[model samples]
Target: MKTSILRWLLDPLTSLLALWLWSRDRGRRPYDAVWRLARVTRHPDELLYRVHGHRPDDPGDALP
Candidate 1:
């Protein structure tokens, strides 16, 4: 079906985005990545240092 095709197409993109967000560098630990993604989406202030637009860390930014 059309939805299945769309899901297949978007799944990789979603995975890639999660990888990018969860990854600090190319050498990302898979478990850490998943945990980070979940943590950031739910309670960003708890674990995430910063997340502002395209910049993950800006000097002007402060963590909670």
Candidate 2:
């Protein structure tokens, strides 16, 4: 249910918001947000590891 809503609704809104933010902020672009999302989704553990001060490259850091 959550994924469906995000895919169908939130993604578009996020894109639009990114675009709007990009237009107002010269330092950042809309594509940056999309790129970050892609990276995080591809490695879901990355964000968690970063927050917990764990190194992703460490074998012991990997979640089973």
Candidate 3:
């Protein structure tokens, strides 16, 4: 319960900070920032590839 509350409060701040860094670095795409942030915050098994039905061994499953 406390963990969930902390996550809810912190996740947006973390994302904003990540995006600010990415922008300062002149990253090519905003989605890249989001993807990078997700990699740190989310479980590998719960990543976009799984939601999109990509197999673990599929070439498309590779991270950017």
Candidate 4:
């Protein structure tokens, strides 16, 4: 419960940050940027992946 609440709070902030950073890049697709940013999170799927295009199970998309 506590973790869920924390994630709810932080997700938006990180997403906004990712979009801002993505805007600056101008070369990356929005979904790609979100995926890159979301990779740092404990659970990317719960954040921006659903709204964006990429699925966590994509063949080569796993985080290193």
Top lDDT model: 4
lDDT of 4 by residue, 4-55 (tens): 3554476766555555666777746664545356545645556644544455
Q: Tell me which of candidates 1 and 4 scores higher on lDDT.
A: 4
Better of 1 and 3 by lDDT: 3
Q: How many backbone clashes does candidate 2 have?
A: 0
Model 1 stretches with alpha carbons more than 4 Å out: 1-29, 50-64
The TM-scores of all predictions, comma-separated, are 0.26, 0.32, 0.33, 0.36
Local distance difference test, each candidate? 0.50, 0.51, 0.55, 0.56
lDDT of 1 by residue, 1-64 (tens): 6743553375655445555665655555453345445445655675544232336465567555
Ranked by TM-score, top first? 4, 3, 2, 1
Which lDDT tens digits does candidate 2 get at residues 3-64?
43554374665455545555667646445554344435555666653233234668776878
What TM-score would you give candidate 1 relative to the actual structure? 0.26
The local distance difference test score of model 4 is 0.56
Candidate 3's residue-wise lDDT over 1-64, tens digit each?
6743554466766556556667776786554445455545555655555334224567776866
lDDT of 1 at 24: 51
Report the CA-based lDDT of candidate 3 relative to the real structure.
Answer: 0.55
The top-ranked prediction according to TM-score is: 4
